[model samples]
Target: MKDVEDNGLKNDAFLAAAASELEQMVEQICERIGTPLHETTELQRQVLAAFGFGAVYSITHRDRLTEPQAHALSIRMLIKPFNYSEQQAVDFVDDLIRVASNEEVHPLMNTIIHRGINGHVQFAQEDYEAMGRNIQEILAAVQQ
Candidate 1:
């Protein structure tokens, strides 16, 4: 019983330290990405709440994505100027809802949004549309 109690305490301390380190790292990453730190933290909380830690960690660390990978992530946002059918748009949203729930990829997907969207104020309708498109594209690619 004593050993178990000690182990539990050690685990708690380790988790606290890890959380602090991750918070700092996230802050730096947000700065480097030109995103607001508060927004990044909020997004992280949302992602964790929605998908749990296991999924988010998996996707972010899975590939060590190259520049091409990063660029691809933003392709949908970039293509927003083009016309899309209503069905296509709805399908895209459905796709995001599906993928964002995946335990393995949700974290990475959330990070992609946190970093890519620049964490500005509530996005306008056009911006939201672009983000939705981006989310759909990202989920499709991740699923593949």
Candidate 2:
């Protein structure tokens, strides 16, 4: 894995302060991603209900991994015995961190991050996004 220059993005204080908000985000994200695949057998969801809960754990460890590594791990850990292309796995991770990672990439995605940025702030959404970035880069960002 490539080593990103440590910029000081390790402080998860924002997450600690925004537990409820994160939880709510997890619930909605997990529900959307964990739905049963109609094309699959068992007439049941693929037991991915744990993704919402499990993803945060994986995401928090982003500092220890490269973006590519994180994406690969996301694929391996996210889907179980079920088969999905590497793209799907990669996209899945991208979708999660993307919102918080880059606000300018898409304006709509920034809605949550922009919520009262200067007043009555609920959370440090940028830090949440930084959590998904390269460890070294994150270090520098956090240091700022």
Candidate 3:
């Protein structure tokens, strides 16, 4: 019993350290990408958090996400914040879902991380541009 308790404590400590290290890596990536460390937007934070959770969950619960389940989750993540129509989101999700079940498994983590960051940047950039246009249109309509 004592041995089991000690092992559990050790496992908890290891997880804590790993979590800390992952945060540090994310901070470094943000700095390297020229994004302000202290000024992260809520959307950016949420995206990162979601990716982190997804990675951990995918790894730990590998069997739970069947092909359809994984595809659905990806679709939901991709479309929740964007102005994409449901059909458009579904199409994009369908196209991108193959990455999760690719044959190459060893480099999956790196691929996932890269894809997540790229997707976040692409969506956020486009969303910001669209929002600006919408705001401008609203202002012009108001003035007229």
Candidate 4:
């Protein structure tokens, strides 16, 4: 089997597609928060970006992750991206939800608000190199 990275053309194409999917996911998330991507406030855009990365990271690391789990992970993942402390992450989630509530995005946040973001996210310590290696291996296996 060819090495996933060695197959430069296919790998690059896959990464491009993955990135585009991530961007679309972020756009959808921002819309759900009641703000169009282009119209989002600077802070909202940052939050949405963090949320998008968080969603992708969770999906990559967890098996069969639910939306609520991904939402919870997004809140936890917001800390470093936003330079927030744990409590601040919770506060940020509350603030985001309040703003979204006004825009009817509150319902999406409501179900996960009480889920708690205080727990440790193992994903925080994941090794990206290992993840890349694993994705390559999976791709190579599937292409066989």
Candidate 5:
């Protein structure tokens, strides 16, 4: 019981910190790119949907799910909420990982961090550009 409580606290802290950092990064990227973040686009919607599942499942599973597990959960989420075909959901998640994180292995595939109940977000640089390149690419892809 004690261990469960402690672990829950730890994961909550980690997720909160991740979210805050991600928010700041988004703002900085937008500022550097000379545009606000795109809030309503297909890609954005899909990512939000995936992250929404992350937000909930991260709490429910709590350091128990792997990236593949998180990903499988996301597929179901996208399908139900967005009414995406199974293949579309898979592609959306895959494209999300590729275009956003520039990763290959199931995104968080093997991290002990949050038991992979996390997104593989990469702000590769924190310069005058404020990591705008990645954001720019995403915007371009989604035509935002």
Candidate 6:
């Protein structure tokens, strides 16, 4: 019983920390993107939803999850609504992760760090025109 109680306390702490980190990141993203949180487009909101899930999961399991494990989890969340095939999903996720830490992932992604639970995001560049190129490509590919 004591062990279980202790574990519960740890989980609670983990969740609180994750929420705080996510909130701060969201604020930063909104600031960088020059769009308030409420004005986010439907697509942007979808991405945020995935990030939210990934953030919580990664934070809670930070000690146990490998880098690949955390990356895969975020990819799964981001790709969930797309209904891509298993192989296609893996390939796309790989491509996304390959560009995760850099400015190439997606322009909006540039504003928000791709680190699932670490919450360490940096401003890649201040060029708004260059930011959404990746997302535009992804959307174009999906439409076809």
What TM-score against the true fold does each predicted structure earn?
A: 0.34, 0.30, 0.39, 0.37, 0.42, 0.44
In terms of TM-score, the best-performing candidate is 6
**Poorest stretch of ten by lDDT in candidate 6:** 119-128
Query: Given candidate 5, what's the lDDT at residue 68?
Result: 60
RMSD (Cα, Å) for all candidates, in order, is: 15.6, 14.2, 13.5, 17.1, 9.0, 8.9
For residues 31-137, what per-residue lDDT tens digits would candidate 6 score against the true structure?
A: 65566657866666555543444353445365464565455544544444334456766775565554444565565543333333333312123332332343334
- Model 4 lDDT tens row, 1-144: 567567667644544444454544444444344556667555555534434443444453544444454445546555533345788667766665564345365543332322111101321344334333332342233346
**C-alpha positional error of residue 46 in candidate 4 after TM-score superposition, expressed in Å:** 1.3
Show where candidate 4 strays beyond 4 Å.
Answer: 1-6, 59-144
Tens digits of lDDT, candidate 5, 1-144? 999999779765755554454355435544655744454456555434444443435443654655765576556555654567999988876755553354344453222122223332334233534234533544464453
On lDDT, the leading prediction is 5
Q: After superposing candidate 5, which stretches have Cα over 4 Å from the reference?
A: 38-125, 128-130, 137-144
Candidate 1, run of 10 with poorest lDDT? 74-83
User: lDDT tens string, model 2, 47-74?
Assistant: 2312332343334353344455444444
Residue lDDT tens for model 1, 1-144: 999999778655644443443343334333443445344444333332222222223322443434333232222222221123455534543444455456365566555545333322112222444433443343445556
Note the residue pairs that clash in candidate 1: 56-107
List the candidate numbers ranked by TM-score, top first: 6, 5, 3, 4, 1, 2
Backbone clashes in model 4: 0
lDDT of 4: 0.44
lDDT of 3 by residue, 12-87 (tens): 5644443443354345445544465346555454334334334333432433444544454444434433334679
Candidate 6: the clashing residue pairs are 107-131
Of the two candidates 2 and 4, the one with more favorable lDDT, higher being better, is 4
List where candidate 6 sits over 4 angstroms from the true fold: 51-61, 65-144
